[model samples]
Target chain A: MNLLEDTWKLEFHSGIPVYKQIIHHVQAAVAAGRLVDGDQLPTIRALHQQLNVNPNTVAKAYRELQHLGVLSAEHGSGCYIAPGAAEKSDGLSAREKKAKLTDLCARFAAEARSHGISFDDLVAQLKRQHPA
Target chain B: MNLLEDTWKLEFHSGIPVYKQIIHHVQAAVAAGRLVDGDQLPTIRALHQQLNVNPNTVAKAYRELQHLGVLSAEHGSGCYIAPGAAEKSDGLSAREKKAKLTDLCARFAAEARSHGISFDDLVAQLKRQHPA
Candidate 1:
């Protein structure tokens, strides 16, 4: 397969959003040995033109990919499929767990405040339990 | 205490990034009974104007907030603090666990393929273990 080919094979009827389809497409490409490290993806504008979607939608997809560290853009240039992304051994679980824990701690903090417990007091208890 | 105030009290010395600082500011407002649901936050453009930062930087902050379900924008109408955001109990842990499990499965799938085991066979083993 030509490494620089922009053949997305975009699908829109999977009940998943287009951005997600884009994400999965990239993941599938990586898995199937199509796209490799340091591949260049079309810019958001180019993708929007090719996919015939709103710029915001393409931007959203790009944003999601960027958030996942799958792509990076150079200002005045274009987005590139990030190198070494293939070797990333699936840390999504760890990130998801940490986000959940942040939310849990926020909730716990609110609850503790409602119960008139000092932040320090609650922190002490949590530290005692987890010992971090 | 003003609802529309853009007084971020920006703290650059904190270990967290500026965008995260913005997220925490909004979260703290909701938690501390300052900003309520449905409040209108400054637009990314306006925020960039106020903070003297690049539009991309402001957009990045807004995008992060939007990802967290904390903000929504109306075209031609600036971004608004998403309604009912305050009552959102932290589901960080659940999200984290699910992300972790997704990564685990992906790794397993890669390994299974490497070992010449069918995807169905590996999935069957996982289903047997989790029964989910």
Candidate 2:
């Protein structure tokens, strides 16, 4: 898959709002450097069709991203990744960072349990995610 | 901490709605058997104070859980974990399960990155979560 692909994997069962999830996906992509400054995103209509969600939902996500300074919009044009967004990394304190890791691990373990992924198999997958 | 403790470690920066996060925490607790049927939940005001979130947020989460049949309410008494909530597990298909795991891993990786957690450290933590 292309790093800049506009794929928005929507999980209806996650209990998170779809628009919020879209914002998360875009932010994560930006953090990973898969998206960078001035990179145009899919149009609201296009993204709506791609995700099978309401166009308004896509628009809301875009608007929220713009408000967060993560996206820039031009009149009658589309949104692009914002400048200096990549520089927003590494702002968290040590305690905040530890909390994030703990929260993430707990969430991952819970999902693995629900998916019937055994502890051993989960460890194997985790190793693959970070090969030596 | 006791499994039934009403402590909610909320991550305000996660972009997930606070109320939804509370709902997710409760559902995850139930799924892990840390919370079970007949388990009384903290009252709205109590949880609001505990998490330092709005009381309405806690009430909204409880209402949503009740609607989803995960919680039962009593007029004067408080909410309790609903019966048969545990048996509601494992209804997902293999494909759906795989998608969930993929989503989870990507999320974990993104968080691990933002937290400046080295891949080695992350793998070590994952290993600790699943001992022989």
Candidate 3:
């Protein structure tokens, strides 16, 4: 069974492009350890048939993943998760890391605040979600 | 001088649509108390000129805000923040609130974990950013 198809859902009306959504889901799955190194991704045609989305959209997403070094594609053999793909921090410099971290923090802050969640509440929730 | 024009930037290359981006910024500004009730938003034309985006994009954002009760349109007088808009919890059921909060938390978790930040590190960063 293709667990990726069963687990990852596509929101067609999310205003984000379909290809970007696919990229995000694949990265997220990799990060969550749901998809591991050497895991084979559904081919463009199969995914399109399952998703009822354009084949080009799946192809674009796969191309982007390949470009990001998250996936390795063989001309006729389908795509596989690249080794060490979960880390995904290979080429980032210290400054770039800091910048990315800052951006992520800002986004979290904005989202939490927008939802009327206090900073204390956010901290509590995070602690509860990932108890040490 | 419109502070919003100076502060709110649109990232055209981002896969998120322009209208959604505008709605998010407006909501974020209100949530941060930067844009309060009765605050006048830029005219659709003015903002379009300033951002060099299509006027319809600005109009669509304003319309969505109005639909959400975050902004009010007064025909020829431009848009203004709706009364008590900051506490935009008017129409949500308790179950809806929980769902939304869970979604936000999941997104934050995914982002932080994907960046290789430990949950402890994320909590520390949140504390540093929002010291209480």
Candidate 4:
């Protein structure tokens, strides 16, 4: 509760939409092991109150997460992280994995190019992330 | 605009929206210098006819580009790549550049984590891109 609140501080001037920010935060939380399978998320109404954002915004974020297979919503039981959703490494066929990797690389390249980051600079940074 | 058509072959089954595909292509074109400042983009109607996508989708992409300061639209004319927009490296203040870099890195890290790409593997692949 409080931890969730602390982790998901909304920056009003970040120029990113509230729902998008929520989506990113939730994904980051799941990636970091802060949220896990079968863990229930705050209801849209509760989150809206906590964040002072529109209920529809929270609903939108939840719907998007559900669509991505990261969250599963029950009619009356609320939302839980989908089973085995955190580990995308599992269940993917070799060809599927390769396709995902290629797609990610293309997206990374596009983003890097847009930010004016040269391939050399990107490689340098990647190297820095893993020394020796 | 055959070149544009060729460069922007849409994949309806890619699980990405048409407008997002359009946005990515436009950004890539700008990064590659294929579209420069003052280059007029196809009109919404023209693009709709060419791509056979909804005109609203093309308009949405153009509006997003304009919001990003990547494209400028005239009332009676079509969209143009915004002057000095391609080179984000030029006008960014030191703080802004650092912030942007940090944001990009955070996004990259999140994406990598989701894809189960370890730092070591990412670094290895990056090194491959830069021999010697």
Candidate 5:
């Protein structure tokens, strides 16, 4: 899995389409700087082989992203994060930022709670997993 | 989504199947005590309606879980968590426990990092979202 989707695997089940999942992965990666502006994406062939999906699926995702200005394509080279894409992806106002933070916290707490992890252990786990 | 999958929505991406996700959701919930032995599960019809999947898919998931002895069905009443289901779900040996903890931590860190949330904020958010 990419850094954007370490926990989220790419198994298209029922609701979300494969292309949408791919789009979300790239957007999340870009928003976090795992993928910065101008970073080249895997070629269509490489990505389909890596993900074991139809080539058309990857192509469709790239095309949608390009239209969204999250990605730009070179004539021969693979697609790359568009300039200012980070800003576009995050277009978060202050309120949205607060909401996003709250959502993240809720998700983190849920994961810890589901695993029977305590509050102190949860904090400690964060420190261990994400050292400054 | 249930408490077990508040953040991990039912939308299957590309690697996991719908039925498997349901099974995992129940196991996680049972291991965490959100679901306990004898707790009633939604009828297949209720679940299929709630999750908007085919009824057969829900039946298949429940059948598999029953086969694993994680759930039991009554003639008139709905399905319920089987006896000792918790133990079966968490059969995590000591080493497995440590591994699960580490995996949870890594996933937590990845989610926080992707959201650009600071470690301090993550901890604070947990406390706020999950008060003792």
Candidate 6:
């Protein structure tokens, strides 16, 4: 799990796409200034070994990040972080999404109450995940 | 745009999947107690008219919620909120995601700094979008 440690963690069943998940974690790191540019990402082979996933899957995730301009490979030095990668604005689209999403959730909860679904029951359902 | 209004708002970009985005908004509503279970969704026709999207897309999103047992449509009375539908534990997977995403973004930002990219440049890129 060195690769997992070196990079951000991952969850397979979060319902978010693998590549997007990677992007999210990377973006978060960039925004917070934990990862510096020119840092070498784990090699695809190394990541595959740690995650026990297919090489292609690792490659695909890396490729997606590269497409996002987050990662770049220079000759044999491995993949390095791009400069000035972090910093999405609080007023940008992402922040808007947070606002919209918050509003929607508030409404859904209200509607659920109008229907008589007990709060306890709702909590149970959300916490109860079928084991894989 | 009644359906859109009555429910949550949406955006096509942001890279999050449409269905998941809907789920996110609804989940938030439920968690925050805005949407109760048994709430009827807008008629497929209504949603289609507002978003100008295919009927199947709207149906698909609804069906997903139904499968999660969030909605129960009556034959003629329309969709109503389900009882006690709004509630998910803050400790569950979602909260974890927030943490991981935050961590990742921080790292990415640091990496960018190491590469000598200014924070201003990063902010500009996020705000600038290629027009469709």
TM-scores, all candidates, are: 0.34, 0.40, 0.42, 0.41, 0.36, 0.37
lDDT (0-100) at residue B93 of candidate 2?
A: 48
lDDT of 5 by residue, A1-132 (tens): 244235547856634578876776777677666788788887888778778899999899899889878999887877888999887645454345558879877876776566554455556556656655
> B1-132, model 3: which lDDT tens digit per residue?
254445666778754578877886776677656778898989999888888999999999899889889999999787999999978743444345456767777788887766655454466556656644
Error of 6 at A11 (Å): 1.8
| Location of the lowest summed lDDT over 10 successive residues in candidate 1 chain B | B123-132
What is the DockQ score, from 0 to 1, of model 6? Answer: 0.03
Candidate 6 local lDDT, residue B53: 71
Report the C-alpha lDDT of model 5 over B29-103, residue by residue, as the tens digit: 776677787888878898887788899998998998898788998868889999898876454443455577788
Best by DockQ: 5
lDDT of 3 by residue, A1-132 (tens): 265446557777755567876876676567667778899989989888888899998999999889878899889899899998878733344445456767777788877767665465466556556634
lDDT of candidate 6 over A31-131, digit per residue (tens):
55556677777787887787677878777877877766777867666777887554332222433433443443344345434443333333323222212
How does residue B27 of candidate 5 score in lDDT? Answer: 71
TM-score top scorer: 3
Candidate 4 chain B, run of 10 with poorest lDDT: B123-132
lDDT of 6 by residue, B1-132 (tens): 133676455667644556655655555555545555665667766776776777777777666666656665566666555664444323224444444434434554454444433343333232222111
Give candidate 4's whole-model lDDT: 0.70
Candidate 1 residue lDDT tens string, B82-101 = 87766552323323423443
Candidate 1 regions with alpha-carbon error over 4 angstroms: A1-132, B1-6, B89-132
Q: What is the fnat score of candidate 4?
A: 0.19
Best by lDDT: 3
- When summed lDDT is taken over every stretch of 10 residues in candidate 1 chain A, the lowest stretch is A123-132
- The whole-model lDDT of each prediction reads 0.56, 0.71, 0.73, 0.70, 0.71, 0.53
**Model 1 Cα lDDT, one tens digit per residue, A44-63:** 77767878888788788777
Which TM-score values does chain B get in all models? Answer: 0.57, 0.65, 0.66, 0.65, 0.63, 0.55
Candidate 2 residue-wise lDDT at B86? 60
Candidate 4, residues A89-122, lDDT tens digits: the string is 4444434544665666667766766666545445
TM-score of chain A of each: 0.56, 0.66, 0.65, 0.64, 0.63, 0.58
DockQ of each: 0.03, 0.16, 0.14, 0.12, 0.22, 0.03
Off by over 4 Å in 2: A1-7, A90-132, B1-132
